[model samples]
Target: MKKIETFCPVRDILSQFGDKWSVLVLILLEDRQVLRFSELAKAIPDVSQKMLTVTLRSLESYHLVARKVYPEVPPRVEYSLTELGQSLLRPMHSLIDWALDHKDECLK
Candidate 1:
C-alpha cells in the first residue's frame, strides 16, 4: 500500500464529484447540451433556487462550467459544460458506473 504522505489531491478534488447536487448538475448538462436556469430548476425539482444558484456559481468559479448570457429584454442565460468539464466526465462516469454496480455492497 502507498504510504500516506501528505494531503492527497485525489481526496481534495473528489469533494465536488461526491456532492450530489454537483453530480446531478453535471449529468444534466451532459445529457442536455445546454439548459436555461429555469429548465435546470424544473429538471431538479427538489433543489431550491438559492441552492442551484450557489451550485452553478461554484462550478463557474472552477471553470468546469460555462454560463452564457444573451442581450434581450427578458435576459436569457444558459449553462453548459466546458471542455475541461467534458474531459472530467470520462473518469466521473467510470466512478459512477462502479458505484452503481456495487451499490448493494456499498449499502451494506
Candidate 2:
C-alpha cells in the first residue's frame, strides 16, 4: 500500500469516515452478522432509500462492507462488515467514549 503524505493522511482518514450515516451504519453492523436492507433502514430512522443505497455501495467498493444477494421469489440482500471494517470497531467505540466524556466542553 502507498503511504499517504503527512499533510494528507488526516484528510484521507476523514474522507473515509466523514459521512455521518456511514459511521452509524458501520457501528450498527460491527458485531452483528448481517442485516437486510429494510432492517438497516428501519434501524437508522430518517435515512432516505437513495442515501442508504449510495452509502452501502460506497462501503462495498471500499471493501469495508460485504453485500450478499440471495435468490428467491424476491431477491434478498444483506450487508456485513469485512475484517478491516470490523477492525474499526475499537477506534470507533473509543471515539464515542471520548465524545461522551467531552460532551459538556464540546457543546460550548
Candidate 3:
C-alpha cells in the first residue's frame, strides 16, 4: 500500500471541520442518508438560515457533502454525505459519546 502524506496542512483541516455548525450538520446527516435544506434547518433548531447556507456551501466545496438538485416545478435540493464525509462517522460518534459521558462534569 502507498503511504498517504501526513504533511497536509492541519490548519486547513481544522478550519473545515472545527466549526460548531459544521460538526452538528455532519452528525445529523450521518445516519439520515439525506436531508433537504429545510429539514436540516428544522433539525438544527438554533442554526440560522444564513449559517446553514454557509455551512452547506463550505461542506460542498470540500467535497464532503454531495448536493443533488431535482428538476421539478419548485426545484428540490438534497444534501448527503459523500464517502469521505461518511468516514468521519466513527470519530464524530466517539466525540459525541465522550461529550455525553462527561457533560455534567465538564459543564460544572
For every candidate, C-alpha RMSD to the true structure in Å: 1.7, 3.4, 4.3
Q: TM-score of predicted model 3?
A: 0.83
Instruction: Show the lowest summed lDDT stretch of 10 residues, model 2.
Output: 1-10
Q: Estimate each model's TM-score.
A: 0.88, 0.86, 0.83
Instruction: Give residue 4's error in model 3 in angstroms.
Output: 20
For residues 1-108, what per-residue lDDT tens digits would candidate 1 score against the true structure?
A: 776655477676666556888889999999998999999999999999998998898888877899999999899999999998898899989989999999999999
Clashing pairs in 2: none
Evaluate residue 10 in candidate 2 and report its C-alpha lDDT on the 0 to 100 scale.
Answer: 77
Worst 10 residues of 1 by lDDT: 3-12
Give the range of the ten consecutive residues with the poorest summed lDDT in model 3.
Answer: 1-10
Q: Backbone collision count in every prediction?
A: 0, 0, 0
Q: lDDT by residue for model 2 over 1-108, one digit each (tens)?
A: 657566597787568666988988898897466999999999999999999999998888878899999998699999999998888778888988998999999999
TM-score of 2: 0.86
